[model samples]
Target: MATKKLRRSAMLGRVVAATATLGLVAGLAACGSDSTSSNPTTDSPTASDISGELNILVSSADASDKAFGEVVDAFNAKYPNAKATLNSVPNDTYPTTKSAQLTAGKVDIFVVKTFREMPDYAVDSTSEDVQLAQSGGLLDLTDEAFMKNYTPSVLDSQAIGGRQFAVPTGNSYVTGLYYNKKIFADNGIEAPTTWTELQSAVSTLEGAGVTAFGIGGKDTWPAGLVMNGVVGGLYPTAADKQALTDSLWDQSASLDSGVPLEVLQKTQWVFDHAQKNFSGAGYDDMPAAFANGDFAILPDGTWNQPTIDTAVAGAFEYGYIPFPASDNAADNKYLNGKIELQLGVSAATKNKDAALAFLDLFSSKDVYTKFVATSGFSSAQPDIEQSEFLNSITDITSQFEPVWESIWIANANAGDAAAYPFNYPALKPLGSDDAAAAAAAANSAWTAAF
Candidate 1:
């Protein structure tokens, strides 16, 4: 119920904005053929009828390749004549490359960060999906049978103008504190459920000469995750969260007042209590440090499960919990649930039948299960069970509220500026003056974007 409430409210602003943009684009692209069909049979092609070389563009992450490769292998078995090859690109360059490939009609299938990148290409006027359908740049799989297999809420979150443009591959519940269970046990410390308890734990850990938290502050984005998790706990409603975000751009709120000040204070606390030289640490170092028992907690996402497992090599136990933001447990109920990846068919592709077939196969329970399990992420498809590692976090994730990063700023570029502000690196020491200055710089950048 908490998850549903959070999702519904958090997604409203983006969805409404996208829907409006889509409407405007639809009006302008009236001459374009409407490729979006609500009729399931129109887009559904049987495996036997599908035959072609399908090229899929995706990020070059190892997990992505492994999971996609497995799906391709299974898909080949179903339709031997249909060959799907993955074209891997660097993660940082995906948006630019994907946009170029889509515009040139060179890519058949591609991965999207769902509401973020896909909407940009889908619509015509820098708007949303309806224009995408009207422009004939994206396929409408609203009535597609494979969609029935996914959780309705998860699928709907990716929808624009009441149409499904992509199918979600995996869900990530980030912004959790992964603690060294052995260290906690040795110190007789339980996972903190409230802000006061979390502070107490940090004090105890620090007094024991154990690092309270290990942060990849040099990477900057990790700092954003910490802020998001804290915001979830501090803000009780989606509107409350959105108000704070809007203030960053609109200048309605100041860094020294309300949520902004609170966030700065909390960030200051984490920085004050984190391991020495945390600001000098890199992203890769955090997992190793935590696994080696150098720290009691590491703030990160569910995606790190495999990395930690590999680092620890079964030497110690660890578990994740939502970052506590408030003294009241009721207010501290949320997790950073994000749809990490979504598979979409290019609207300009000539191989529509093959693309449709691949989508169907990819969304099938069997294929999707293997992909999610291999990636060490929770399955967005309700019928497919999450991996054992993900199951361990069910205590937090089951009742988790969606993170602001996923809902408010799904676009990678916008997210970078909105989530990881400029001058955030300089604010590491957490002075009120420095935090205020950083917030001002970030707000200016956001305003310029608009």
Candidate 2:
């Protein structure tokens, strides 16, 4: 079981975009009011007692798709009269597809990531999910019996105004590296606990005739993961990161200097030690590259462990650890994460009973264990059995620390770097500019918005 935190240190806004379908959402908002929008049928039924056709839609992920499928299979098995179907769309098309389905009244359960609150400076800002929820487009699961299966603290952090709308199936720790255990032992270096030690380990690995890091820069987001690791280490607490955001928003901070500069420089250092042409390398290729001992470290989310294991094929042992960005080991103990597979029952859903029943089945201890394990996500329920890989990183995940991605909302008016708010993409081989120059450009864009 993941050591449950009594409370999340902070809760932040969800990144907003996918605006093409906002019109469909707004136009169909009133249509969803007829049924199960706010108050669904009060009678809650177990799988065996409910009978209705169900359609579930979600964003695509290699592991998540498989897990949702298994849950649906179990739902069918348990609910004899239930006919449930899942449509997992590619991430690129998921938003549009979900909107299209909702407009057509074809989806029951769908994925949702939205704001419970906005920054003080942006009081009126809203995301697509916020709009959907406000427009009566989602069923409120606040008082649902199935929701009790999750940890109260976890649910509280995701709730808006004390009302829960989505079910967090699980989450993933993202601010860390997947290191080859054999490579570390062979190099006479243990997992580093400080920024200096990590730099030394990188040197030791490179001295042993190996690339220090393997990043899938071609896909872009993988490289961004390294930046997240840097931020997590430099600003180890929610208060620290929030202060930085406040300073930036008030024009009291600059990305080109202070800790922000350190973030850029350290991430640049990581990329510098990576395999040649890493920027051109594909994310799908890194697992095999590490499996073949092409690199000593791979910085990524825990969600990729199962995929990486498939490539490793039992050739070498690997462990995931916090990146240790700070000089103090104690400060780097927590791993930053974001909730994954958050499920919302569409107000437009016609089969409310079956949809609610399926969620009920999915939340049960035995079924959720299988779903989370198959999904490669950290368990969201307290006292629930965590997957073996999750168990390995229990030291870091003992605390519930939301990642900067989850806590920081991107400024739409700012340039690309400000969106990431780090500009890892603009540095070095990923782009033509050097780290300092990239940070300067990002600073300029961020400042212009002020």
Q: Assess the local accuracy of residue 366 in candidate 2 as a C-alpha lDDT between 0 and 100.
A: 89
Q: By lDDT, who's the top model here?
A: 2
lDDT of 2: 0.79
Instruction: Give candidate 1 regions above 4 Å deviation.
Output: 1-34, 41-46, 92-100, 117-134, 236-240, 247-251, 399-401, 407-423, 430-450
TM-score of every prediction relative to native: 0.80, 0.84
For residues 1-450, what per-residue lDDT tens digits would candidate 2 score against the true structure? 111211111112223343444676666666664743354434546656778789999888877899999999998888888889999888768766877788889999999855455666854346667667766677878878778878775686677656888899887888888899999999899999899999999999888898999998986788888888899998887768778888888888899998898899999998899999999999889899999999989988887787899999999899888988899998789888888768988877777778878888888888999998777789888776776778877767766777777666556567666766887888888997778998998898888766
What lDDT score is found at residue 223 in candidate 2? 88
**Model 1 lDDT per residue over 59-151, tens place:** 877877898888888777888878888888997687667666665667777775435333332232233433454455567778888888777
Q: What is residue 122's positional error in candidate 2, in angstroms?
A: 4.1
lDDT of 2 at 305: 81
lDDT of each prediction vs. the true structure? 0.67, 0.79
